[model samples]
Target chain A: MKFSTEDLIEGIRSGNKRLIAKAITLVESKKAEHRQQAEELLKEIMPFTGKSIRVGVTGVPGAGKSTFIENFGRLAIANGKKVAVLAIDPSSAINKGSILGDKTRMEELAREENAFIRPSPSSGFLGGVANTTFETMMICEAAGYDYILIETVGVGQSEVLVADITDIFLFLKIIGGGDELQGIKRGIMEMVDIIFINKVEESNLQKAKTTKLELKRALDFIPAKEKGWKVPVLLGSALYNEGLSDVYSTIDEFISLKKKTGSFEGVRVQQAEKRFEYWVQEYILSMMKKNNSVEEAYIQHKKNASAMVFNPSTEAKLFVEKFLSKGPD
Target chain B: MKFSTEDLIEGIRSGNKRLIAKAITLVESKKAEHRQQAEELLKEIMPFTGKSIRVGVTGVPGAGKSTFIENFGRLAIANGKKVAVLAIDPSSAINKGSILGDKTRMEELAREENAFIRPSPSSGFLGGVANTTFETMMICEAAGYDYILIETVGVGQSEVLVADITDIFLFLKIIGGGDELQGIKRGIMEMVDIIFINKVEESNLQKAKTTKLELKRALDFIPAKEKGWKVPVLLGSALYNEGLSDVYSTIDEFISLKKKTGSFEGVRVQQAEKRFEYWVQEYILSMMKKNNSVEEAYIQHKKNASAMVFNPSTEAKLFVEKFLSKGPD
Candidate 1:
């Protein structure tokens, strides 16, 4: 099952599922040889990427995120589009796996021939987890997936990270009874492009309507995340497959609007630049780890700082001056 | 007005207000010679710093932040403690100045001999602004200020930055007519060590009670920010000076709890470490800017990246390798 670099490129280009998954594994690997091959494969597949609509979905737990994605994926396939689903859980290591790791959680979407699902890469720092997810998205795109769905638990900073990598950010929430809207996370309200109120049915229809209006009022206090786009909140029952078409149409209208305004391309470009910056920061930190002089200086300064013998800022300045003059090995 | 370094140190140690202000101006300056002198002053003052209780206060506009600080400062001064108030507004440039710049904002407190007020520094990036504020706090501490109050607009990322440098983070909010708790910014709730429901008088007392109960329920969903502390929500009217004593006592209790648990010193050490890291990052970025090969390669890679000829991550790796091996000059 060990594919050569050329094999990965060819297999991925031909939409070979196994090879696509293998390529993702390669990219996620920390091994130096695997990383070299992964980089090579990523370069070869670059042109084939950026062909899909990347959507990020986030919500509190028990909000029916998996059901919504399953239904959404199926709907996309019904329209003759291939779909790929990926999860990003920074806490995935302790949680065993993300919601997507258990295929049965998304059984309907998992059985679809045009669908692909990958769990959160249960390891690494926040940036690394996000990088792997981004790489996985690219691999899915090269495999001809027309839609990419990225999921994140709305509890942490991952929501911001996911919003950075995707074109559309969809927030899903469910109101238990009353006054739960205040529980919506802080900065997330400003980042959401569209919102889905899941689990709306006969019993909670009135409650959902009230929640929607309340949410609109709350949204009024915040500025639009994007120009020429008013964030829309739609109610639905994902478990019953209710209101799936509305969700699809809303996404359609949003994508077409963003594309027409040229912000679609603009966002992708910004995302690329941000991605580049992150990689540069990672590279610099890694290099610092390997440089003995930098490490020694850092430890010495830290000790001095803790003992109150030197100001942290002054210590940092002195360390940097020494580091640059001697060069990092 | 031009005091030598030794004279400035003596003046500060003796608690001369003019010298303290001059020292702050020196640290805030970007001139090379001034920076060297500032560093020296900071190292010499190290033994005198870390004596004050640092408190950060943030609230939405018109939430009576200035009035609250005025009343709170008066309370501290009445208790035989000197207090210094500083503001941090990232949007200060366009907004003319932070709420504190006018002096009239806290006229009563400004007139008190025990109180010193400094407006937000009207320049630099976010980190630079925070660094200046931290240095100013140290200078105030060395001058025997018993309390340092840092104020942020509670709108931007400044709340997080302010939280990083202070020992206690207090969030002041007022509930309007109905359901205004939803207006609370997301992540701020998690960082708050104490919450003050400001403007709680006869008319809004009922409304404030509802908001308090609702906020407490919402807080239930979030884990404790610190191990031994339970975040408290208090009610008070800053303008009427009705609940100033309660706010002061709450802060006193929280600080004592933190000190008893040893987390007070632990937090300061962590803050020191974070400050050092930020300075290092700033130094590296500045070095990269001055390095010609790094800039040339950056532009070339940027061009290739925009043209879709090179993946940004790979480009970043290549650039770092070249920069480190050749040394940044």
Candidate 2:
């Protein structure tokens, strides 16, 4: 069970499941030593990592996000594609509720030999660019999974982050709007390239149809955020086992279209740039957090602010300038 | 007026229009010396800010965004408030077209002695949270402008950046959602606290009404992103001067509710924290951008990436770590 960077790189290329999972654990580990090893593993496997179709799936708690993903994965498997599932569990930091989102929920996909599901990192930052999640994705892609499905309970910063690393961001809704849509973030609506109105069964069929039209009306107004791709709204009942193919094909159409328009590579570059920017941010903040003077300056400036002697912008600028004055030689 | 920092600060406090414009120019100056003086001027007038009802307005071009803001500003002034308009002309950098958004567009408001209008900084870095905008807002507040109207084209980073500095974020949309909403960013939709469906006069009234209903349906599904308030969709015609009062009152209600819930100050603290974060980010990026070694590392790493020798996560970590290794004396 010992996994080194080469073992990981080889196992992933040859499709070794246990070794792939081990590689993921190393990547998700918080220990500095483990992170070093994980980085090495990822680099060794870099050649194999960009071959898969990476799709990010997100929705609210009861939006049939899990069911739709389950059926979608199974459909992909049936179509001769090996599928790997990864979930970004934001709530794990609070309630450990993400325990319920694992293999138990995607039972069929979990039981399939061609499908591999790794639970969300128990120690992730929950944002879309979780250091470990991004690394884990590289591992999955290198393991020769034909499709990488990243699921997140669309809340907090997940959707925007998901869009950054995902090829096509898919938001699944359970055929209803009313109060259910109340909790949905509009940013999620904007980032999605495809919308699936799931759970359109016997009684909800008409409602789902109407919801589709309404979505189309609103979405039709939204010029394309992504290049050369019209955001499409489709219907499905994951429970009834229907409409999954159309969903799959539409996703296929999106990738091919974006690829043809050069947006596929263009988006990947943008994602890389965003990730680079994020790292610089996190590193600088951490460095300043370690400096006592920055803290003192903030306290002094905030005191001055509360007393009406310093404005917020001035206070912020002063604090930053103080840090820069002491910044690296 | 030949402006000194102290004179500019006093002029702003005493409501001198020329002095206030001078203070804004100093804040917007990229030169280190000017930035220092701007900070001093801002600190001098810090006590006078945080009193006005700061409203951030955004809408796509041709969506009556300018006309809507002009009416909104005038309505506030007519209600016994001194209105100051600071437009975040994002397109100014590219098209140099923000000239039309100045006093010439809002003739009545522009001519009113009580109104102070600053054309969007012709040299502003397109995104709305330009540091100068923050300082300009403070100067306007100190100058006794009871209402601060910040207008931005809804298509860029301006709306979200404006949201960080303003109390209530308003998105102005004309009747139908189709092509008009096309250019609108999804983040703008999510960030807005109130949406005004403008141009609801004569023939466009019905379409506006239906758009309102459709918006309500989607908004109702979205739980309030902020506490103690519901995102309200209002009807308005800035051209006809109808429904402007409702929009104003709804904004008033939002501020009052947020105040009662203590989220008003809570949001301010969050804004301050985000600004601090952004400043640190900009400082680090700038420092690295100036370093030949970092640039060389990036090019080499990127080359390795294109050759499949480094995954993005690995590449980013290596670059950040290189910077961190060289950070702090």
Candidate 3:
């Protein structure tokens, strides 16, 4: 309930799992006191945050996301790496509990000594991931985890935001599914760095191969974000643990290549800038709620217009002008 | 360009395509004079709009979006309805032209007497549809079109925005291709009112059917927005015009059902509210750019606190405060 900044920082720095988990819970809490504590914790851990590779994995409800992450995490650990799996389960608004029954679905990998699995319920965010997922990843990284795997619900806009925060975005797919070639929303696919054809075992093996070929053809029509980094379509079987090693190797190659070319740092800087922007937007929204001026004006505007009269633009301009005239923070 | 708002309104009411197009161009233009003219035009034509059914069509690139619209528009015309197709072409930053060659692709539909096709470039808006697309739809509605079809580049955030503005959202797909179910973004699927398994001709017929079944199964798992209104998965050959009537009937059914429940009016009101909000946001952004004090402060904020710069939320709050302090407009 009461944690000094130094205590949290030292606990996280020493890789104290219980303390780290507690800190994450504190950060994720909505209580007023918790927010202040979380902010202090973040500031203290800021210096050690950017060292790890944060990878985001997202797929549809039955897309074998958990199975794939468990396999992938195991593969990374086997390759002598410290991996942390942050599984974001979709939460029910009414109950405020995870829709997915339990985190035990990924028990095998969770039991591994080198792998850490934490399932966080996605509470009230449109994007499949939680608002604090980014901060959680940073905390995980500061605790000396080299690989932070963010597992998203893959059901909403949250995955894209999660992708934005992660170093690599893996979009998982099931082979021979009807949605194939049905033109996945370009927004999500465009953000994807790696496309994994999951459930590539037994009867689906050939279909997975065929799907990969089709995906490759489709990728040609899709413009690449950066040159030389075409989104590779890889085959994997989370159930059988097939091709998991190859996936890990490919990730390593990507990270190393990005580091060699300075893109690793470049991406981090961009992400930091984006985070700053997000914070500002969030802080302003909070400020608006606190001041209630926007709401008041909105009410007045509605009365005068005799229609639905919440004009965000005009109201925004007024808010900015008043805030600026007050001069410096 | 210098015509009076009355002339523009009269011309549009009289079904003058040139005048309607010119009015929309004026609305889209950044010029201050054009904006003033556009405002006047909107005021005059406001009553005439809201009669037309605005439908948004989106799919991945090479999903034959232009061809589908061309076919769909002809179908609407065959039903004795005046159709307006607003096609947003994917713009290349270098060439500044749409990659899909919109005008040429929909040449046949454009030539039809009952149909009007206007190909607009994306112009770098986040949502696949352009900023002016909403206003363009209004302009088209005012011009006496019974059905307005907004065709987005389908691959990005634009599709979602376009869907928000339209009454019904049509998601097109190519059979036996791409990532199938796993590849398509779940958010888009959930938002879609009708999922058309497009290009269902020749060798792909069986595949399309299977895909439809798979989609039907997938739909069962996700929560439906409209109670009892199943998100129909229909197979159609946009190239050969097979099952075109079915698509029209489905749309008609949806509209009739909504009307019966008074949801049609509710939806229109919501759309208008959305448009107002969008315009307000745009207006505020413009005002922020024009205001010297806010501009200076924004710059100083960026410079002084590079890492913690004010985001849109903060800026919006400030803008609102400023507008309120300055007294009523």
Best by TM-score: 2
lDDT for B201 (candidate 1): 86
Compared with the true structure, what per-residue lDDT tens digits does model 2 show for residues B49-112?
A: 8788888888767678778877778888788899998877555677566534443688877888
Residue B13's lDDT within candidate 3 is 87
Q: How good is model 3 by TM-score?
A: 0.64
Model 2 residue B290 lDDT?
Answer: 61
* TM-score of each prediction: 0.81, 0.85, 0.64
lDDT by residue (A1-329, candidate 1, tens digit) is 37898998888888888888899898887665776787788888898899999999998888999999999899899999999999877677676655577757999888899999888875663223344787788889989999999999764678877987898999998989656675676577778899899999888899999889877766665556677888999998888888878978888899999899898898888777777767777677655556777778878887777666778878878887877776656
TM-score of chain B of each: 0.91, 0.85, 0.87
Residue lDDT tens for model 3, B244-275: 78889999999988888887777666665555
DockQ of 1: 0.33
Candidate 3 - chain A - TM: 0.86
lDDT of 1: 0.81
Q: Which candidate number has the best lDDT?
A: 1
Ranking by TM-score: 2, 1, 3
